[model samples]
Target: MGCTFRPHFGYCRRISTKVNVLITVSDDIYDVYGTLDELELFTNAVERWDINAMDGLPNYMKICFLALHNSVNEMAFDILKEQELHIIRYFKKRWADLCRAYLLEAKWYYSGGDVPKSIQCYMNETGASEEDAREFIRCLISATWKKMIGEQSMTSPFSKTFIEIEFNLGRMAQCIYQYGDGHGVRNHETKDHLLSLFVQLIPP
Candidate 1:
């Protein structure tokens, strides 16, 4: 797995970090800050994947969109130079899809209607307590992991490295959110986890 990333690991890591940061910022904007109309404009701009679309966005949004556009296009440019393959359309579509999903979430939130999430739906249908609903979610996660592991053992169209990366990403998300909204909330556990992962070195 480590060998698969040789020579370009630092570059890949940097791009991944930038992309994740952008995603977090975009999520925050759609979830807590941006107005419905503003979100619509932002989503449209992402879908269009045009720098000119930045003109109508607010100052903060303009900054965010430009960063996203530049970072993504830079990645696409790197790939094109290395592989002679144009992938900007795929990257743009992914960003557009993510923004559209966020826009839908914002719409649901601003609508002020009861949008039952999986846990809520389970609780509502089963008359389960919150704790039970949480346990149910845990079970579901465990089951999903089992399925993922099973699938990994079978022949897959994805390369082994790609599958490994995908699995690691899932694990990373689980670890991050295990303590509770680790990405959004500042807590001691998350701090400790980050320190262990990135700061502390193990004895050889």
Candidate 2:
């Protein structure tokens, strides 16, 4: 459930419209992009691709939506990695086994028409204080990416989009972390060594 870091090629065309949206109450991000703002970005994903109008999406359109999806997914990877490590460091095998079991359960629940329950189980597994559990939480985002974006829902069969999304996530995350040194002070919005280091790492 992790990205190996690579890029996928496709034509991305923008579609614009308003949407009825839900604001997620929480996040795990390297930076705090405003929730309403990101919500618009995501709602536009569906609108931009004309997803709401379609009864069923063709494979090509699905791929385009997946790309937009992953770009938003990138915003949270760094914070997810940080918390995953903390939990994994504390919980050990119990957390690992629990997450594994929960992964199975989530798959089962998803297949069995208990989607909200499945999401809850997935989140519960992630909330534990174990390395494996936490690692699952972090990498699971990639798993989700592969499933939704690559059309491979089973985590065991990951694809390039999944790997590249996480890879790009990691790169940008390192950029964000190094950009601030956790000071959360000074010119966070300006050019600095941390950002310079990020540029060196990814050449952005």
Candidate 3:
């Protein structure tokens, strides 16, 4: 199947404010493994409005965050693993707020952690009769393509082909509803006018 396509919306209510806050921090902690103290620093500071506390951190912080988030849940650890990789590919330097937001997608449902969204994406992408909430690895792979590869390739010296991030989102939603059952993506509905672009390209 091809990537998903969604129309561009000018902006959401807080997207602009959040984006400005998310990308303004001048740090990429992906490279530097944090000491116990360093971990506590950002963990504590993140709650506040200032991200400058993370400034100049190594590039490995992103990695550490992914690792920590995965360890928080096992049922969806596999999906979490791919999600981590997707974030790593894009930042290539540090973890961003958007990454953090998606990582926390599950928190909104099933109480906390990657409870269903991640698994739903996996299940939807794989189109597997996984019954136990399984997913195709390709969805996460496409995440890297849509968020990392496609975004990065766009500015690189190569042909810039954008992956349809919107399609992946639907597949994700399908997985959420399929796997989540009663506890589906109640926190955030993935449906959107954007899904219209898929037409015959992706399954509804």
TM-scores of all candidate predictions against the true structure: 0.86, 0.22, 0.23
Off by over 4 Å in 2: 1-155, 181-204
lDDT of each: 0.87, 0.39, 0.41
Count of residue pairs whose backbone atoms collide, per candidate: 0, 10, 17
Give the candidate number with the greatest TM-score.
1
- lDDT tens digits, residues 57-126, model 3? 4455544433433322331343347554333233322343543443344234324334455557657777
Give per-residue CA lDDT, model 1, range 46-133, as digits (tens): 9999889878889999999999999999999999999999999999999999999888888888889554677889999999999999
Per-model C-alpha RMSD: 2.8, 17.4, 17.9
Best by lDDT: 1
Residue 12 error for model 1, in Å?
1.9
The pairs that clash in candidate 1 are none
What candidate 3 gets wrong by more than 4 Å, as runs, is: 1-8, 13-35, 51-204
